[model samples]
Target: MPDSPRLHRAKAGRFVTFQFMPSLNQLLAAHAPLLVLDAASTRIQVGWLAPGSAHWAASFAEAGIGLFECLDQLQTRPEAAGAFVFCDGPGSILGVRTVAMMLRAWLVLRSRPVFAYHSLLLLAHARRDPALTVIADARRDSWHCAAIGAPLRRVPTAELPVRLAMPEGFRTWSTAPADLERIPYSLAELLPATHDADIFRAIDEPDAFLHEEPSYATWSPQIHRAP
Candidate 1:
């Protein structure tokens, strides 16, 4: 396939043994490096974080690419085997599943740990806004809704709840462009900013990391829940 216009990479760096996974406590306790992958968008993103920062280093983003392609490039990173963080989602089902499955395989084959971040939580963190609402297309005339620091909720478009919805003066972010214009939300792609690598930097609780299989939300009746 022809390379997409958005394909990019920053200056690379040496890999470290420190990683985050299985638990945030282990991450902090081990002071390991972190790898974050966001494959739920039209464009895929790969980034890394140092031991104690929320900033990214040598992060890369590209459109018209698949998860394997992103992993192909990531394989060059010295930290490829480190603990990984993923954006488990309510976005593209295939995209998220492929990435998650590949990472799961890596966990078995390489013994690397895996952690998950809610798609909404990632968007809120990227926006650096504590009060914004996250909206992802849920099909069926409904949408998946999540506020910063809150759990996920499904809401109908026509009957949007005023209180649970984006509050006045608060920004609304989404991964789908159509959702941006159709739902009137802002674009907050999952690519990490230069200053932060690990999205889980500030989290200290061990339970913050996932131990079971990651899951993505869907509206299709035929599709079984992700495991």
Candidate 2:
């Protein structure tokens, strides 16, 4: 596989090196059949997505069993050695960290492009709404909330308004099934389309997010707890 830079500059009439940036089209064309590992929930889900594919193949294991173990087992299959997208999240810290660590290792050893997307981005893509709000349990007393096509933040569950109303005309999507008023979309249906560039742009830039190690987001003490 070619690791050529996206843009090269001529230094003294010689083309110097530059960094490589892959687009969604290139990724799909060069490495069709993308694998997705979503550990953003209590259940660690793994799925396969390809452009224009008619179906999405997926399954999950309990996070308590250890996501790394499940991923290791899944990796034994022939399809595991390829480009992948991982759900970098505000869910189970252990699960997300495990996958993130593995991806960084793969980047150094295999040089495969491992893209990360926020968990809410997946929900937003599934809802297919122009403006949307996604609220997921952040564990403890907070909620992992995001205004899709906008920004993300952690809000306290106690401060939730007395009435859960959509902001203006925006649609509200929540994983809380009891909130029957909120619209819920099938995650499986969106997995295939989730590999596009729009989602990739949400990944934190390498220079800003990665330094001593490859982290998916800006360093937050709350997000990155010392081990």
Candidate 3:
């Protein structure tokens, strides 16, 4: 019998890097090479970049798990290294943090390399050129959103500032606490199609922040809770 071909064996020295940057374009442009674990609600998308080629991974996270919680495949596969996680945020603040904790623990249990990303930016990367507004629709609190355009304006949780800035003909949608779907599209529009330049960035779980971020990044829009 012939030896079966495997990715781990096929490509050695390939490290799975977890890049938690605020901007996808920055990440992708910076890293000349890598693979990406672009996970989100109900789906985990993967993509790879080799020498001169760029392709997306058709394989994604399991069906039943929450966004960014897909680790089953990484655990089973004998890849060069463990998987990396780029978490998004803005709505599920605590849930986003919990997922990080979960990823770290999972990595420790499986001996994998884990990384982080500003969860909110994932959507920002997906939809670019919209007035990026993060609707902070928490169960118990009022709603809030922020504009990412020039002269960045942080919308008041109690009142969406666009209402006042918009011309008479321009329309702005209101995000109620119960309305989750309405806002995702709005959020997606702001994200520019992008990712880290080098998909693989070696990183360890963080216990606390040690220094100021060199770039302008906001940890926003967490949609779920860590349970």
Candidate 4:
């Protein structure tokens, strides 16, 4: 699939991109029997979204083991699903990457459309609170911030709002801001409210979300001389 052109903005020493996604209802309508995976937090959530009803399974173990556990509980094979949905980031990088790697391997066996969504964006859409500022630790004294109607950005911790909502089970390195709200990050809890919310986007390749594409500078060989 061709890459979709996305709008990007530079903020807090990173380039952020605005992603648009379709809702749960929309996904079910078009692609029933969908297999959804979310390992963006401490919990590993797996769901089988079919017409009329959906089944959710979860595990709290480490990503590598927990993912398979949840999948086993669901008991649905990859080929049986019409399409696949995955949470792309703003949470556990290793967990997110684990899910992405599994999805890529599954794609090798059988090709299907895969969709991606940001963890904070999903929570924002589910909560439907205009004043709710969703945040996740971005390390280096910065955080990933998302609101109902704004693009996601990396903001310095000192600049964060007095009150903020963080998804449950997100790991934070710095001191949490005052008046921080911990919201449910489970798919079973969050997905119910997002039935009509547009928060999923189709992705050709699956990978953990990065604020900017990594770049490396070329080095040339030269004779060294001491001054």
- Candidate 1 vs candidate 3, TM-score winner: 1
C-alpha RMSD between model 2 and the true structure: 10.0
How well does candidate 1 score on lDDT at residue 175? 32
C-alpha local distance difference test of each model: 0.48, 0.51, 0.37, 0.84
Candidate 4 on 119-191: residue-level lDDT in tens?
Answer: 9988998888888899999988999999988888999988997658999999999788888999989887788
Residues 46-134 of candidate 1 have per-residue lDDT tens digits of: 65455445433221243224544554655545245356766666565555676666666665655554566656555554556555566
Supply candidate 1's per-residue lDDT for 69. 56
Task: Output the number of the lDDT-best candidate.
Answer: 4
Total clashing pairs in model 4: 2
Off by over 4 Å in 2: 1-26, 54-60, 63-80, 158-187, 193-197, 201-227
- The superposed Cα distance between candidate 2 and the true structure at residue 56, in angstroms, equals 5.1
TM-score, cand. 2 vs. native = 0.58
Residue range with the least summed lDDT across 10 consecutive positions in model 1: 202-211
Residue 93 of candidate 3: its Cα lDDT?
40
Q: Best-fitting candidate, measured by TM-score?
A: 4
Q: TM-score for every candidate vs. truth?
A: 0.54, 0.58, 0.44, 0.87
lDDT of 2 by residue, 1-227 (tens): 35455443233434322244344445555555556665655456665546665233333554434445554555543235456667666455666776676566655665444666666656665566654556666556656565546656666766653323121112223443234234333346555555453555323221112113645766646665788
